[model samples]
Target: MSSEQQSIKPTEKQQILQMFNLLPDVLFWIKDIHSQIEYANTVYLEQVGVKNLEQALGKTDYDFFPPHIAKQFITDDKKVMDGELITDRVELNSDQKGNIAWFLTSKRPIFDEQGNITGSYGITRHLEKNSQVLSDVQAINAPVNFIKENFKSDIKIQQLADVAHLSVSALERRFKKYLMKTPKQFINQTRLEHARRLLVETQLPISEVAYQSGFIEHSYFSKQFRLLFDEQPSEVRNQNQSMNMKV
Candidate 1:
């Protein structure tokens, strides 16, 4: 091949990675040992609210996601780097706008020619496209919807169980089986997510944000928020404000 023609040719790895861009509902990404993103498909970039892959390269999940979500991602990445193959793991992810959604993820370690593990790659499919997987957890739909709609109020496990039309124990078992969390944990998570969004988007006082998010005790709200996100509510708000100023 002529020099110019050879220069224009895509490498084998490039060709394979390009295929992922065509899968609209599937997000694909590769990350280095440190969990820095090395490559991401178009869909992955879009999901993270970046216009192009260049904006995402060299960034870790912490850059584009809430701390709680990023922590889970880092944990999974560590397992993959340690040569554990993660398959069909259900996970919650938030976009740049902090809209949370469920996705099915799989990850595997990438090895170099010398057989040393160098990095990892993962694929995440939006659960809506995977009908069978969605149906498997279909029993929780009512409860899930209830939590989303009523997170601002005092939510109870019995309320969720009634919404799902299952006994409290059965609901807990199903939650553990499908969502990997207890009913109460799910309620708290839903409330915390709401509070985080409010903190980033509104100028409300931290205590008010907690109360509006269903936590009656300010100290308890701060404790759970810090425990889950590794940051105080005021810190989250200030960080977002700084970012907005930069823009």
Candidate 2:
């Protein structure tokens, strides 16, 4: 075995091979943009209507899926190429068996030494167990993650609520119930933390920092900064500079 293969822990290797023995959901692995098969579990053979792994080896997705399915997957594959690591929960009818199914396809790009997108890895799992839990988790985390990442530039409470597909009041209640904080609190906290990171890490001007950190007004930014830190932005910067000089 190669060093990578040799590094697999004994328990992990057993567990991984155990997953392969399952026949309900197929696991596929592809390396490179060509979608060539790297490895497949025993479940893949049953689902793909193939008799053995030998029959499934060395094939591209084009060999498995029809032109339409192949085209759509190819498009989504290029999305990872564009630096999106995504896990899509979708429902579909299998072309092989014409059975309607619901599953999630999760994939992220693997990068080369210089950070070029080299290949991708993904797992597909059936949504048979605990659909409600999955739904609740998505409903709770999706909006928070989005607003946390894109809190800048005129984000209203209503917009974040709308993203959750909940009423303004209902969204507030959900945040309070699940997160123990109001939506506005979450927004402010996210912005404040992000601003602190940028202030300490980057050489950007304070005015630009305010704008980029999701504060529309410099005065409001300063007031909040002092409220949070008990010091002015200049003081924060000068302290950081002195610390760096000492090091």
- In order of listing, the candidates' clash counts read 0, 0
Q: Scored by Cα lDDT, where does model 2 land?
A: 0.67
Candidate 2: residue pairs that collide? none
Residue 175 displacement (Å), model 1: 0.4
Per-residue lDDT of model 2, residues 182-241, tens digit only = 888778766765676566677789888788889988999889878755567767667656
- lDDT of model 2 at position 150: 88
lDDT for position 16 in model 2: 77
RMSD of 2: 15.4
lDDT (Cα atoms) of all candidates against the true structure: 0.85, 0.67
Best by TM-score: 1
The runs of at least 3 residues in candidate 1 whose Cα sits more than 4 Å from the true structure, single-residue gaps closed, are 1-10, 22-24, 31-37, 45-101, 106-121
